[model samples]
Target chain A: MHFHKYEKIWLIFGSGSLIVFLMVLGFAAFWKGTHPQSHIETIDPQNIEAHEAFQAENLGLHEVEDGKYIVNIVASAFNYDLGKDENGDIVKTIRVPKGSSVLFQITTRDVVHGFQVAGTNVNMMVEPGHISRFETVLKNNGEFTIVCNEYCGIGHHLMFGTVEVY
Target chain B: MSTKQLTFSKQESTLYMVFMHVTFVSLLIGGLMGLLQTLVRSGKYTLPFNIDYYTILTVHGVILGLVLTTFFIIGFQFSLLGKTVGISKKQLRAAWLSFWVMLVGTVMAAITILIGEASVLFTFYAPLQAHPAFYFGLAFVIIGSWIAAITNFRQLYVWKKANKGQKSPLLAFMVTINMAMWVIASLGVATAVLIQFIPWSLGYAETINVLLTRTLFWYFGHPLVYFWLLPAYMAWYAIIPKIIGGKLFSDSLARLAFILLLMFSIPVGFHHQLTEPGIDPTWKFIQVVLTFMVIIPSLMTAFSIFATFEITGRRKGYRGVFGWFRKLPWKDVRFLAPFIGMLAFIPGGAGGIINASHQMNSLIHNTIWVTGHFHLTAATTVILTFFGIAYWLIPHLTGRTLTAKLNRLGILQTIIWTVGMTIMSTSMHIQGLLGGPRRSNFSEYAGGEQVATWINYQLAQAIGGSILFIGIILMVYIFIQLAFFAPRGHEEYPIAEEESDALPTPKVLENWYLWVGLTIALILFAYTIPVIDIIKHSPPGSVPFSWPIGRS
Candidate 1:
């Protein structure tokens, strides 16, 4: 097929840009080890408690090392179970020291839910029977609201939590 | 002036008009639902009459996104076929059958959603199941669309057989590619519905494999957007050149773009599921690569369009590198509307790339930004072009003329839509970056500080949505005048011609078996392994939940 001179030039530029984008994404994935929150591990949605990490006592934040932590969360309709505070009240807020690396492992017991720390680069689609995980360093000190970005149910808007780095 | 006017027969015209009627009514209803959503999301007003926000959201998505677009596209495609390649009486009969079945399905789905039985939104993700009727309704809609696809294919086949060695008309070729893609891609969702959703929703099954259902939906879902878009591309590539007083830039380039789009559009569904688990990152990256390959055709399309404009303008005695741009018919709604649509696609296309990027999807996944992205692509770019088509197509089909007054009103309507969309979509993007969610009703998020940051944007969305509602009202009025009240006269069904020295379109591009074979091969390559992995190591299925919105 014949291409006009200018058309050929435009295609080169356009295709080059797409190639550059793909290269950058490849670098991020293969070199930097960047991936979306895909865990590829499954657990029973109906019997999530049977999974070790999802058991009530095991859920929520755990200090794995100095300046490092892991938070296991169970998401359901309009709720994010972030374990409990010392007072036994449902832990609605998770506090961590600034400059800490945090890994969030989350799953939903019901429909598909979205776990997003608003105003940050932390997000995952928390689906039943699969674990969705995202790890990021808390470089900034502030309170970030965690919201369900996916439409789960009627009270989808009601689902939320908080992450405080200090 | 001795050439005969190309027009649809009266029977063909009447059939298309009926489709247009459904299209406009859907615009009104869906537009109203959209207005209500923005209002409720603003937290300034509550839905009265015990109505739920999710219901209206579902209505807005289904009616406008699915119903209006499908009816307009199929109707418009039929006309294109009728004008280019004669539709057989048998084919016409089949076309009408498709229309009725689709209409019945639409009514069933609409009534089910309106009564709040299926507020699962347009994706209708599994586990959050809708009523059996809703699933059946959607199945019928898909089946009906398949019938239309077969009819379109037959229309072209008959023409090709009689012509013996001629290139088919460009628009008919495009319509066939689109329907071919639609039929093949929709099979994924059709299978999911028939095998998974219908039985599960009807309580014949105890639980659903959520990931499996979602995968199938996105397999269809990604191309579903392209299905909305290719028709607009049809207008942009073929129809717009005629409206702009230019020949096609290159017939070969346009065909190549459609062919590329068909090959790359379907196998990339994993990009939508990038943030989900149970899918390996390798496969996700593979599909993401395929997704980017789809962009090349669009890039080609952009070049072809610009070349068309420049060449046409230069031919019109305009001189200077950019003078051709100034030579376009700014006053004509048929050109202006689609031109604006073209302009919107720049940002729309850019945002689409961002959304599909493998890891970067986390930045905007499920955020209102994603919503904003589509508002630009589908709602503005595609819908505006469809509006542009309506400005003439409606009148052409109805044997009426678009009076100057209506044309001016159309310009005003276009302006209103552009402004409204800019405001709403911009605010949606910003609020989403600030971490606001899409498809959610109003909430302060327990008075969180970030939630406070989104309120002003929500209010702006409401203001913008209200303006869009007014634009819709104006559009409906213009449709009425163009359809029934305008002076009876001949309106051209503008189809652009090839330039005198344009290269012959390669016969290889028309080899359906080769293209379709490549398309399926790519799909299987991208999806086969990952899909098998999802099923093999599957998580336990969950029973259906309908307490919040779906029927019990």
Candidate 2:
């Protein structure tokens, strides 16, 4: 029970650990300060106007050949449900055109997020200061869930996006 | 006729032997899988690579990564901490049960993956589903591991109960931290599997949230690496000195590092998801900063352990920063484990610092660079420590002295491990920088000339992997020889000198550092969770459906 006298040893250990912990904390703080802020700034998918207008045309065609269509994809570590039925089931689908290659330039305004076009071989990482490019051939037209493959935060799994191949 | 029953000590030894047997068998299976993958991928043998790649890859990951590591943890826990904590017969039996469940589950999982029924990378990302049995088997294995973690903590708690005010023995404290981390990490995955993935795959839960499962898994997955590394650190802190003719430099530092590991390791799991698009970049950045922050304990450990070596070397009359190196026993497996581990630490730590850097991480995230980085840290450093512990401790536990010649060969095994890891890691980093993707089954040439020369690198990788496998086999042989053929005469074993022995516990065991550590854990955990919660409930922007607020 005489650990009190061992303060010398504990101090050696404690002080050493404290210094290192502080150094690392300093590094993280410095890095965080230098990096740009990464919060969801805008969500175009939720725009009712954009949804209804592009409902027929954008039915899975993420991009057009030489035609500029502005679609904003927000990157989140937590889960976001892109496909859910009216009955609160995951039955909602996306429709994509067949025999077309679409360029899906995804960027994360916030923390790291994964853009995985499920079942058709698409998985890309979106970082704040970076744009992740995924160009894929729409071989088969079916509803695909663009799920996040990376573990963001607690809600990382619910952060899903929808892509329909028509 | 008189019947001679074995003592509980003997029983523990038998239990330890069973785990080692499982380890050697798993290594052989993993090695064979590696060899087969090499042959087929190199086109040296003409066989349909179709299902074989997935099957072999799964087997390789399961055996080497999870199963082997699990066995090592159990064995190390029983051998080192068990004695110190004075684990009870009932709890020891419980530990035995945990081991069996893990072994059985591993077998089931390996068989399922081998048949191409479960091709999901051990990551087991959702939607890209696998056989239900595969998930169940994994669940079983984890449940068993959870049991082991619980038992370890329970033993420590009981020890604390019996010997209140006495500081938990150094080894017990480290193992306790490891066990605590295991419980928290596993809960994340267990929740996903039990509530979401398992039920969804079994047709019980309709429309499972893929995002939730990933969040849960990585929460579990990242700390799981620490679970693997901390025991090796224990061996370094607690055992390395005895082998090298010196006492531990500072037990308090060892304990403090464990506390830091438990505190910082879990919350920083988000860094792994940085490249993914689902999470807020702000939080990802926070996690990255935290990830770098976690390096503090690592640096402290490096300084403390190295300082321990210096103090020990000075005691032995060696002088200088590198001068301490001369006094070290180069050929002793016990000595070589920490030496090689620290040597690999140089690159491994550098890789970690690089990977944790937000901008630099972008360059090599999910590429062969990440693969190379972890190989040096996890495979080379940690596994070498495992070998050293087995070489030094197993004989003592079994009342034996191993053949010094094979122990010398065991040092050679560590050399092979170090060399093979360096070659593979350096080559993989180069390949990743040249834009080679990681976790890919096949590599294709971008043009007629192969844009990144990925094919050559992949070929080189297989060769390096094979060498690593051979080195693993050498380890298996050395351990098996120690267990079965080594002379089990307790009287003949050498006793360490007084000066070389670890200092016994001090008079007053109650220390403020322990409470201070717990306080920090509380603050850090408290600080991070709410930030995560605020982000969770805030409007998810036009992320498809009107985002559910506060669903959980």
Candidate 3:
């Protein structure tokens, strides 16, 4: 019950800092609409192709507007099914122009995986049966590697892709 | 109370010693696994004997994170109970049963992991299932801990009944609070294991509900860290003060912190699931708020610790603002090790706040920064405090003394550990900021430019880890010395007394019904709606995938 004068002062300083942190977090989450990659819609892991976004024709980048795009990806153990390019080659590196706003919509068929465009704020936990989504503008014209941060399986480290912004 | 009254009985000492023995063995094994992990990740050495990297990673996580911490905490808490409130013969017998059950379970699980059947990592997220025996073994471990928790509660309950109206001993009350939280929180994991994992892994069920199982795990997972933490807090609050020749700064304040931790730790597991899908962001935000509430108690603890040092030093005629800090016993390992633990928590606590910050979790969520954060918090702050306790506790129990020579060795060991962790954790944080992922084996990532940036940090981690392995070797040597080879003498079991002029601790602080009731209410409020939403709007369950990681 007895708080030394210094103890009280320390408590005030500590609590004040914590409160400031909470206020900033709240402003980002509630006011600025900053949330993690949580999408409420459930997709069937076994039958992902049945879902509109995950169908073969829709698995890669599609420009919804001049500078806005959505990339649908299906993550599996040891691989990211990033759809094919015009030359019928698997799209390992996604290319977009600088200043383009891209929304990555991803899900997994087996086990939990991670979708993180390294060195960017685009990170998400792609779980089975749920679509994880993160939208960010390609501000820097550089190649960002996409690595699976979650331990999906033995070849977890081998699972990586690239995003090039020109 | 006389020293004789507080001393553990011969049988009691043996029981606690068994736990200590298991703890040290785990430290060595787990420490080795960690060293190997760093070496492998450095992109220099490959694991020989066809040993998979994930297997060793699982070993490190399970042995250190689960086995070492659990055995040490339960054993240490039992000793606290025996010292503070006399444990009956019946309670002692039950404690032994708990120990055996836990040991058996640990062996079963350990063998399974060793033989390459359960490399699912310590978290063991379902759908990537392990062997059924692994699940069974983990279940037995939980049940065994339940026994220990029950014994602790009964020990304190008997004491309260006999000495009606008297407040319980501070350490005993703290032990009870921790046990109560453990029981309540572990129910989530226990349910997942018994009902979901066991059935699915055994092929009785065709598929496992992924989100449901994870929700249940994190329900227990967040509190799992606090379970490792509160015991260290126990030593910091009660024992460390006495070691420093000071009385407890405030009895009520310490009790209040424990109560608050119990309340806030459980309901906030959603913070871990923030980056995952299926869970609503609103629930995550709410739990994030609750997680921040838990920080209040830790902040209070920081203040109390500083105040205890300053007041004690001033009493010894130290004058300047920082003179009190200088007055602390730097040469004594008993004080020095835990002091370093306290120093580590400053950064560790800051990292935790950032990790739990709603959207900010994206910055380091699954990155090596999170790994660095915990190494500082659990591995440094908590483990170092345990070492500090061991320097005296082991000798005190074994009728031996921490010889001045061994004390010097302890100081050296502490320095080695500090240097090693600083280098390792610092590099981890830097690499994580540069987009390095955790829980992966060594990879060049096809020579990507960003991947190239992480190699130097990885090499630094390997160096740091090798040094840490050396520290572990020294610690184990010191443990062996203190347990058997130290000089035979009475090493005082220091328990600080409440200051004579301090205000009486409020009766409400001891009101278990009120506290536990509030704890339950908060957990329900935080969990119920989100949980229902997860199950109601559920995804189709998936069959097991054990090909790459686990044996069928």
Clashes of each: 0, 49, 0
User: What does candidate 3's lDDT look like per residue over B1-552, in tens digits?
Assistant: 112347688999999999999999999999999999999988889999999999999999999999999999999999998999988899999999999999888999999999999998999987887888898889989999999999999998998999888889999999999999999999999999999999898889998889999999999999999999999999999999999999998889999999999999999998888899998998998999899899999999998898889999999999999999987999999999899999999999999999998898999989999999999999999999999999998998999999889999999999999999999999999999888999999988756678888988999999999999999999999999989898899998889988877789989999999999999999999999999999999988888999858464
Query: How accurately is candidate 1 docked according to DockQ?
Result: 0.82
| Model 3 clashing residue pairs (backbone) | none
Instruction: List per-prediction Cα lDDT, in the order shown.
Output: 0.91, 0.63, 0.92
**Residue A67 displacement (Å), model 2:** 15
Interface RMSD (Cα, Å) for model 1: 1.1
lDDT of 2 by residue, B1-552 (tens): 001112337777777767777877877888777666655545455346444454566677778888888887877776555557666789889989999898778878887777666766567665445667888888889899888888887887897788766667677777777877787778888887777667767776644444456667877787888888998888777767667766666665566667677777777766665445445555665666566556767766776677667778887788766888777788777778667887887888887766765544555666667778878887778877877777756676667776778778887888787777777778888876654555544523212233227667777777787788889788878877777778876512111222324455453333435644663564366336634643464333212111111111
Error of 3 at B435 (Å): 1.1
Interface RMSD of each: 1.1, 11.5, 1.1
Which candidate model has the greater TM-score, 2 or 3? 3
Residue by residue across A27-59, what tens digits does model 3's lDDT show? 888888888778888988999988899988788
Grade the docking of candidate 2: incorrect
Which pairs clash in model 1? none
lDDT of 1 by residue, A7-36 (tens): 788889988998999999999888998888
- Return the number of clashes found in candidate 2: 49
